[model samples]
Target: MKNFLVHSLLLAVLLTNSCGSSKINKTSNPAVPAAQENVSNQAIVPAADQLKAYLPLLKGKKVGLMGNQTSVVGPNNEHLVDVLLREKVDLKFGFAPEHGFRGDIERGEKVSNDVDAKTGLPLFTLYGGNAKQDSIVKSIDVMIFDLQDVGARFYTYITSLHRVMELCAKHNKELIVLDRPNPCGDQVDGPVRKDDKFKSNVSFHKIAMVHGLTVGELAKMINGEKWLENGKECKLTVVPVQNYTHSSIYKLPVIPSPSLPNHLSVRLYAALCLFEGTDISVGRGTDWPFQVVGYTNPVYGDFTFTPGEKAGMVKHVEGKGAVNYGLDLRNINPDEFKFTLKYVLYFYDKMPDKSKFFARPEFFDKLAGTDELRKQILAGKTEKEIRESWQPELAAYKQMRKKYLLYPDFE
Candidate 1:
């Protein structure tokens, strides 16, 4: 079984790499002048200036924008909805993702529908029950999604995109994805979601946990693969970001989500989220969620407990507080780095006081997308051994993802 999993992963990786070279013919080339390209390439101007190409296409269309705070125009931090409205684009509805339109809601908290203070438009909640379906978007001609994705598969924003795309296909409505940079770039990592075991709003389709595609690229992949219900396809239009390469990490003025305030939080989300399966606080109900993980107990050895204003733990080290007990390696060492699966396995192997670490086996199993990660942790497998067990499955997933990638190969 372990050998089969490793082989499947390898095959997927190879397939993904091969698919990067495949290209589809374009029907018609939009007339984008050389001056515009030059202007877009300039570092002084906003990298998102390429969105101007779609202005002619969206001039007078009744549009429903599916976005949040991060959906801004450029360095001026101009709101996309406001820009469309000012341009007489007939902006109708605005859909807010998990953290509400303004990105104020806390994690796991329900966001209620309300009227936007600035635009006076009714803001719909896509995070709640029955909200992520097609029923809410029936009043508009085109649904434009412009949220910033942190490039993690389990992040709710990607799932929100997935459901919105599915709904657009069902309603036969035109879907426009305003492309943004993937902060994590094109580095695929971790395991793919298994078909039979894990399927949720978070893990809807089979993709690596740290999928390295921009939201627009993901939309293209999903449509090209016909991953929507009954193989349905939406009238998709992707407004690609000009001058934006896979290497560029865009520092947008608008916040993507509440918990993910900065690139630091986003960089840590994929690794730290593993603690969610454990009893650790994960710094929820505090200023920094996913930045720190700790519990109330002080009895655990090798760590000193220092209480913060909001019940946190700091290590014995200077300047570092107690609410943080786990590995705090922020800088990714490109030379020494392995895949996320291997990194996670290493962390699990070095975990201190396994008995004190409160992780439900079922919860860990679900979060990891399989029972294998959990079983290996419990079985006391060394990090090397655990990673060796997953190489085959990871390789298979990499190969399967090839045909779905939309960006140039950097690997």
Candidate 2:
């Protein structure tokens, strides 16, 4: 206890000392359009930032946080784990998803189950489909999910959220989802997941790839739709962000994943991630990561980038020790990106070697949540045809999604 207090104090000092001369320009209300957003404005306050509203519920209860480095609070940008410790909230064990507790681990790298070095708290690994264990869920009275989601189906954090929600429902544990903004909340593009097949860790729910809902709203849908075990809903409580709406443009204070290091990358992730199913390198080894898509071929896009073994990019896709040339999309404004299939279609049409383009067909199908897309792409269907194919399903999904929304939607 003494050691934990000392560590907390040290963290407090470290965070306090980080008070820079530059003011934190948080948006006061994000109900306006993105083009109107300014440096002088204050954005919507996240639910985690308003601790007083929900911290009382955790008093005298064993707490378990299912979070990562993205789980932060306030204008100062302090870690939620540290804040809880300071508040004397009894945080029992922290459950880490894909990137691990502190989010230092690489993407899909199996984070080892161990104790947190700073707080001395036992941190369990929930990746690789391991959090469903009965032993872990029963240990906590309240399971707090406070991670930032990029609002993509393949992102994997929401998959963890789905599985954790299921476990919480079955175990009868109080699931508190401290809601954060969906950076891609405004746009609802791409196809929705089919009912049968292609369901995996990435395709947790049947929503569209770029599902425009906060974690809280999604949680409500999971319960409302009776998506849990035997149609049982989890005891869920959503701490919603203040002054946030579906149209509100949320700039992530921290990168949600290792590959997505900035707003541009996060914006491009929904569409560019499709490149993963192909032989293309989505700037994995570069600083841009998801912002650029490149390969060593004349038929590909004019822009080019060579992969390298760098931090956050421990392994570059298909570019091991070799330079892969492709497009560099950094110069383009992220807001201009609609996350449509135009880029993917264009690349597929240009590549001379059609068979060699998609190395992992199954993985691509998994990401898209349907083999129909691949079939359409292979058949040389136009982007309009493919997007039109998604209309019925996407429309149904949007209608269903409206039922569970916690705030103003992107209507």
Candidate 3:
């Protein structure tokens, strides 16, 4: 206990001294939209920024933090883990989700149990498919979840959210989700996961491709709907984002993952991510990942880029050692971007060999949350026809979504 206190004090001092009075800009790049410098007059304050509201809850409890690189507080972007330590919150252990504690781990990479070197805290991996963190969940009095979500269903942090919530419910531990603005909170398009066979880590719940709910709002839905094992409900508390509405054009203070480097990449992710199931590369392993899509063939497009390995970010480079040709969308206005199926459809239509287009059909379906989409594209269904087919289910989901919403609706 004495050593831990000493270490905590040192960390606090180091962090405090490092961040004097210099405020970090929302977006480092001048080209991308700035953070919370959106259309709304008020800046969206994340739940983590309001420490007073939640610190009391952890005053004496053995708290466990489930967070990643994006789990930060304020303009200085001090990590919540460090902030909690500074506040003398009895944080027992740290939990890492899909991207690991620092968010360096590659997408879909298996995170293993380890210890956080910085804080000397035991780190358990919740990204492990099975609920192996049962013991960790039981040891904690409360689990604080704070990860930035990109508002896409297949992003996998939400999957980690489900597993953590399930374990919390089973062990009878309180789960607190620190809400952050969904970069694309207003978007609620794409096919809702309806098929049981399509269930995977990516498609954890039956929601639209872009659910448009903040983590806090989604937590309410998860508990309210009784989606847990045997309809179990977690003792959930959601610290919602202040001055945020569904329509608020909030930009992320930090990149959610390594691939989504800028505001534009994050905005385009929902649309381009579908290309993961295809032979085409979504600029993975490149500096501008998710901001461009290309293939080795010159017929794909005039714009060209080469995919290369990025250590800890992407281990296996997709479309490596060859020039890939396709769209360059780094300069597109993020605010104007809307979730659409047209990009993937265009690539599919261009592919000379239809079978090669869906290089990983099963994986594609898992990402889509339904096999119907692949079948629809294969059948050459127009975007209009495809969107029309989703209306009935989408309409029902929208109605159900309203019950759990914590902010004003976009509509």
Candidate 4:
């Protein structure tokens, strides 16, 4: 089954890659065609386009940058650090986010501090042991953040930004955010975290699961809305993208991280991430993480699905080939479809070998933000019933988010 799925994915990739070159322009609002037309006329450039704007401010000051592989100059594809080094912009040090400076590590993997091979400067790992802002920001006059975010609350990179921003505010250091497009764009979804809820490293802000703001806009919202620690705001400057529309999704020239190779993976991550706390292997070791999930259970053969006339038959036995299966669910509406813990619990309950499924109570609770979801799942509640329990909170969150929205709404 693994081989079959791989072959199917390869076929899809080959077919999609055959299309001719086309420019991916940044879009604003897809709901209103007139608004999209208005945004397109301005012809917004990427954050890298405004490199010259920072040169004057950066001169004679110790500068620190928080960026990864995706931080590059538009059109030329030059690394931002290398460009700054050539222009002699007083680049003091480098800071890496989730996947380190090279963007090679897997999700939740720890990165260690190291020297960059190309620039030979100290690269500090903000995603590992010593991730505190004071540990990496003491000697720098200003800190610039420019990492690509997948626009999901669960994604750790944005939390890193929030932590650094708080520290910058505490120390009174200037913080500049080189904005990029939110891959998910302006379509917000899911419940917002409450003030009394656990707001740890994974969730730093009180926004929805899919907050519809760019990093720059987020900075502004944080400051303007007073969402920071003790109601203190950072001295922030957002280098806004020119002509960027909320509806556009850019095909990044450089891969941001190993797991997120393409937009398809990003799209699927929102739903599949729920399985992270479960024993299911969401294709981490394979080429397509989040695209395929399999387990070593023996009953996989019991659930057989035919793929393309005589393409292959997936057997029910677990472990490798016997348990391999793929899902083609582009037709599902992400916003309307309700997801709850029961989806996972029901599968685990029905599996013949329940011991094969590992359930870490703490880990699952952190991922879902409460043990109630897990407890109810374990108690055999259906997905619909579980979703109904959270409806009131989700509805209240939706109303609260309206005041913070930056784009105009059609509905």
RMSD of 4: 10.0
Model 3 Cα lDDT, one tens digit per residue, 1-411: 222222221111000000001111222123212332243667778889988878887878999877877777778777777788889988887777766666667776777766666778776676654354667668879878787889998887787777677777778888777788898998799999998798887777889999988877776677667677777777777776777878888788777777888898989999998888887888888888888899998878999999988845556467987899988988889998999998898888888888788889999999999888999999999999999999999999998898777677788
lDDT of 1 by residue, 161-194 (tens): 7767766776777777777777676477776777
> All candidates' lDDT scores?
0.58, 0.73, 0.75, 0.58
Which candidate comes out best when scored by TM-score?
3
**How does residue 251 of candidate 3 score in lDDT?**
82
* Candidate numbers sorted by TM-score from highest down: 3, 2, 1, 4
Model 3's lDDT to the true fold? 0.75
lDDT of 2 by residue, 1-411 (tens): 222222221111000000001111122123332433232335688888888878998999998888877777776567777889989999987777776665656766766676767778777766765534558779889888887888898888877777777777777888787889899998887889986598877676789999998877777777767776677767777777777777777789876667888889888899888888888778877767887776777567567677776665784455655566667778888866768887788778788878987899998998999989999999989988988999999999988887666666667
What residue runs in model 1 are displaced by over 4 Å at the alpha carbon? 1-48, 131-135, 285-288, 296-358
Sorted on lDDT, highest at the top, how do the candidates line up? 3, 2, 4, 1
lDDT of 4 by residue, 341-382 (tens): 433664567666655454655655555665676677666677
Clashing pairs in 2: 26-42, 26-43, 27-42, 27-43, 28-42, 294-326, 295-325, 295-326, 296-325, 303-326
Candidates in order: C-alpha RMSD to true structure: 10.0, 7.9, 8.7, 10.0
Q: Report lDDT (Cα) of residue 319, candidate 2.
A: 67
Score residue 395 of candidate 4 by CA lDDT. Answer: 71
